[model samples]
Target: MTEASGDVRLTGISKTYGSFTAVHPLDLTVPQGSFYALLGASGCGKTTTLRMIAGLEEPSSGTVCLGEQDVTALPPYKRPVNTVFQSYALFPHLDIFENVAFGLRRRGIKSVKKQVGDMLDLVQLGEQARKKPHQLSGGQQQRVAVARALINHPKVLLLDEPLGALDLKLRRQMQLELKRIQTEVGITFVHVTHDQEEAMTMADTVAVMNGGRVEQQGAPAELYENPRTTFVANFLGTSNFIAAEVDSVSGDDVVLRAGDGKLLLPKARCGAATSPGGKVLLGVRPEKITLTHADDAGTVPDGRNRITGRVVASSFIGVSTQYVIERPLCDAFEVYAQNIERDTRLTPGADVVLHWNPAHTFGLDAGQDVQAGVEKVEEDA
Candidate 1:
């Protein structure tokens, strides 16, 4: 086969146990040979969705199709898919080579040396072939697990938080490594992860799930830049939201009134209804904001959305100084200013003016809880 071809198509698929619905009826597509991630916090049904695709969990309704073939009723062993779990689940007694070769041997493929060697090289673990699972580092063991799964030439490979057992540094390294391997093999990859950065960094497309349904799905940049819900805005990274009332809407902009200030949101950037006098939540990512001491506030570029606030807390996180600012309407709003020029006066209690291009601002429905995705961040941590 030319690269284990087939788009994974889930149509109106869902799972429920007794009274509780683990995953609501949902339609999704993982493009052929593409890296797709099901991203969410615990209990969000990302894993349930992934399991459904893998034929490990039967859908309460609908179908799971790989290209033109309907595999909804197939058992896990019969489907053209393989799963790698958080636990490596390696045979401790076998060396790396045999572990990866086990599937080939079970299928009675005797001439497996070259296939096994090439697979090991693909994961950069050829040198570790003689070593047993315990002799390898956690990262190496995970790679071995991945190598073992991919060697079977499954049309789709499902990774269920495969790097969750590694340390932070190793997990991040594996993120890049996994992406590299996927690109090289050109196999469809369906990964389930709770780590926002991991999903953004490794997957070509990410489906953000919440409360058993997908809240948003798009390229990483698109989802991060223009989130449609408060949950997505707050959970994707960190978003600062100011409750506002729409004062007017012109050709390309919706003017909002918050406290004593007015903010401009580009019409295309707003995802909420913009009726005259309607309430909406104005949103901006922390990194999109620039903090200027109130003394130099007049120097900020014209037409930027500006808010007056005082720094409440500050922490130096190497690349940038993250600040908590308290303003009229919103409490504990965040701003991340890069460490380009130190603003000595931006310490706690110091008055500051926050400004950013109006185009960077997004609008969300104010009726939804502004804190929807906030606690999920802590839960994922």
Candidate 2:
């Protein structure tokens, strides 16, 4: 393979079907041999974007480049890429060995024994070579699909919700398996999925897509820790946003004034309203907050935002206790505290104080919808 073999780049690429635009003009580059994931909900254009890169759907405009070659107008078979769909798509009559070897045989390549054997071993299915798709479990069948795709030695591999059909336990197992296979082969893999956890677990880089555009793209931990948009703040994980107005901005520190309390936030963490007197939303992750009794508010140390509220509800979920605290800044502020000591004082209707370091807080533009990523549940009439 050439030095640029595994890199995939899309420059101003977009797709539209009839009057509807599936993907807006966007530019993205997937680094060589990196595991990348396109994440979003249904109709968010993630799959459409992936298809454009794979040559399955022609882009309305822009160029698709693999390595140094412009493969924008190339067909799926002409591009040096392979795809694994949600369905394994293996022939029922073909055994595992034949299925994996089929790709090589179709390309008129003879003597595929070593190549087929190596791929099967890579996916940990060497012993199951003789089994048909129907005879194997979902996980095993999925592995066969992977082996078939990898046997061709494509520069890039695209997975479209390949593990969506498996049960939760098997799905989790395959996630690790896929990551391991990608690392072993050293091929660029672009994965498309709506599952946030799957993207976080398997990909080295994740691009969060919405409304035909990428909202943000970065390392999973980076995006989760410091989300710039309201959608990202709520989509990747649970975030409790407190409405506040800017009171003062000095150097790297910006003070926010909530109802009767003051929140000191780092300017670098503020997504908007860097100047004073502007409206903004202060954000903190559920796990980053510490809960204390309302009576103990005075005992809390300085440099942390301390606010008293009543616990509206709480669920003891084995690993941690999740609480919904009703406060003046927001109707419901979620908090997750580990059951290390199992504070019995925190109960429904109990008064408590929520405190966390100023550095842990972030800010977002208040003009955007407060509940951008909340799942909408239909109520029965």
Candidate 3:
């Protein structure tokens, strides 16, 4: 697959079914030749957004532009886009070569045989070119579908959960293979998926959607490390959120008093303009916290946040220990500790303190409804 120097722009694009809205007005941009992902839970509009880009579903409003051309009114077959669906949707009687050649042949492309041969080689399936769709394994069928879409050399390749039918191991392998193929083809890929890990691992930029709208968009690491909304924080990874009151503000750091009386986070986590007596939510990743012995009140490191709790449960997970610690005021907090030889000891029903760097905590505005917010947190966790 060679990278296409084509970018896609979606401006206020939306779709509706009579009175019901499937995709709210949304805006997005995919850089030329980048592997972009539309990621979210089911019913979050990721598939609808992808369909709009592929011209399978017409937008109820706004325009879709591929590179510099307005394609809002173009039909799927006429648009410079091709889709590889979750089911592969391969012709049962068609062999690998035929499947790859289908698109080119339908368009009356010249040198179809040579193009199909090149596509088979591109996907590393040349040896199985004569095997029928039923004779190939799930992963191989998926590769054929990809090659079929690539044979047309479309400006943008749209994949709708293309690896959903594969097993865990195959899915992981395909994530890498998909990245390689996207790079080789040099075509901008617009992928729709509900798998967070998949989006993070394969996408150059990820658009996190919710309630038919984009909640946030950024590179995987950027969104993971500095999530602006509570939804983004909870959805992207495991996060423990503690409710707190702004006790005071000093320079760039805001002093917050957690419900458990812990006054530890620095201004870096709370932002620069938080005022005294304001309410905020503090988020801490499980991996950032450490568990220490019940009686050990070792000197807390400078610029570190520390709190004490009783270990309610502990589970050994080979490489690390997962501990659920109950705080006096806040809900239980989870901590993951590496099973390093000397620090491997932890037991349920023991009292222990959790410590993490202050900079690792993120302060969020306390405007969201507590019930709805908590539900999202539990769902993501």
The model with the greatest TM-score is 2
The CA lDDT at 267 in model 2 is 93
lDDT of 2 by residue, 74-127 (tens): 899999999999998999999999999999999999999999988899999899
- Clash count, candidate 2: 0
Local accuracy by lDDT, each model: 0.92, 0.92, 0.84
Lowest lDDT 10-residue stretch of candidate 1: 372-381
Ranking by TM-score: 2, 1, 3
The TM-score measured for candidate 3 stands at: 0.93
lDDT of 1 by residue, 1-381 (tens): 543246899999999999999999999989888999999999999999989888878899989998778999999998889999999899999999999999999999999999999999999999999999999999999999999999999999999999899899999999999999999999999999999999999999999999899999999999999999989987899888889999999789999999878999999988788998898989999999999999998899998888888999999999999999998788688998899998899999999999999999999888988888885323554
Model 3 segments beyond 4 Å from truth? Answer: 1-5, 260-273, 342-345, 369-381
Error of 3 at 238 (Å): 1.2
Better of 1 and 2 by lDDT: 1
The CA lDDT at 182 in model 3 is 94
Q: Against the true structure, what is each candidate's TM-score?
A: 0.97, 0.98, 0.93
